[model samples]
Target: MKDESLIFGTRAIIEAITANKSIDKLFIQKGLQGELSRELMSLVKKNNITFTYVPVEKLNRLTRNNHQGVVAYISPIDFYDLENLVMNVIESGKTPLFLILDQLSDVRNFGAIIRTAECTGVDGIIIQKKGGAPVNADTIKTSAGAVFKIPICKVDHIKDAMFYLQGSGIQVVAATEKAESTIYDTNLTIPSAIIMGSEGKGISPSVLKLVDQSAKLPMYGDIASLNVSVACGVILYEAIRQRL
Candidate 1:
């Protein structure tokens, strides 16, 4: 992470929050107590921002400057409003195609998924606010600048987005190896959202329950699972093929 992507010092961080800066994460020194810290905590709670209390050494490791036991990582790109984007897509008389990522932590994988989403004409990509990969320089480079071409929405949880998409009459599909059905058999030629999970865990059970359908890629080789980005590409392009 570069200094440009970080907001250091207590007051500076508070100001950033007040100004509505897209902070990816916040780190505060453990056991720090003061009026400023209290105000910061109030703001963080009011905004529902993700934060962690870390040792002073951890803060020092982030920046050598006088950070006043506070540092916030800023998101490189602005996040889109999921509801408005969905409405806009519907009003445009086009079937909405969205990609929802559940706790995907790898930056390169996220970037690659974004690139594929752009190529497949996906309307937007949704990710959980806390666990998803940050849109930073590395992600931008990995996507070959495709990140800028796509709309990314960060929500508090993936399940909520899944429900909203379902309520809107859009089919929500999950890509998991545990599924008995294959992606080719699923009807992806309508308003749909494909939910891909983290590299380690396929998909959270809670989220999987909310999906309209679960589909998996057929595997003939030795590997039980494919890389997350590769799986996403395979499924998304499958949707594209059906639509065409």
Candidate 2:
């Protein structure tokens, strides 16, 4: 956080926000009031940067130097263009296999999904920019170096990824408990993108409608559903089984 370039003063933070830097989050001293503070808060709200209002003591602990009532965490991963990634994969002369995470914010879950997708030979992983976990050190650690080798594309919306996949001739296969067919019965050899939803809400309805096929993982025990990462492993390995 103290890399000089990463740590910014009040004016610097405002400039970075205006420049559209990918800030991970923001921290502001509690009860601080001024025109500049108001503008910063407005900018944070408009840019969707998570902010925590804390006591001055907390800010002091964060940085003894002059923080000017604000600090922003810079993102670790550089995002790529989803369309460009899809096109590159297609041009490489391989059947496309993509995994899309719909609002899956858990870092370990995201990392585990990346590991599974890499092991299963998925062409790419698509995630939404804001709702999902940032590709931070924890994600890289949890992914066990898989994140370095795998291609991950972050987009503004999950539905945009689905539409692009469909336009590129990749069938959208959504994994959900509400689906009629089981994952085992679903065909996976075709060029496809598999989407797994967040644990609580499941896949968003708009994305669900864009899917060409929907299948669920079977459950024999009394437990209703699997963890998002575990379910991702099962479905991705099913695709690997089919392709092999």
Which numbered prediction scores highest in TM-score against the true structure? Answer: 1
Highest lDDT: which candidate?
A: 1
Which 10 successive residues of model 2 have the least lDDT summed? 1-10
Model 2 has an lDDT value of 0.84
lDDT of 1 at 143: 93
Q: lDDT tens digits, residues 1-244, model 1?
A: 4558888998999999899898998999999899999999999999999999999999998999999999889887889999999999999999999999999999999999999999999999999988778898889989999999999998998888988999998999999998999999999988999999999987999999888999999999998889999999999889989999
lDDT for position 219 in model 2: 92
What's the count of clashing pairs in each model shown? 0, 0
Tens digit of lDDT per residue, candidate 2, span 129-235?
A: 66777777778788998988888887778887888899999999999999989999988998999999997899999888889999998899999999999999989
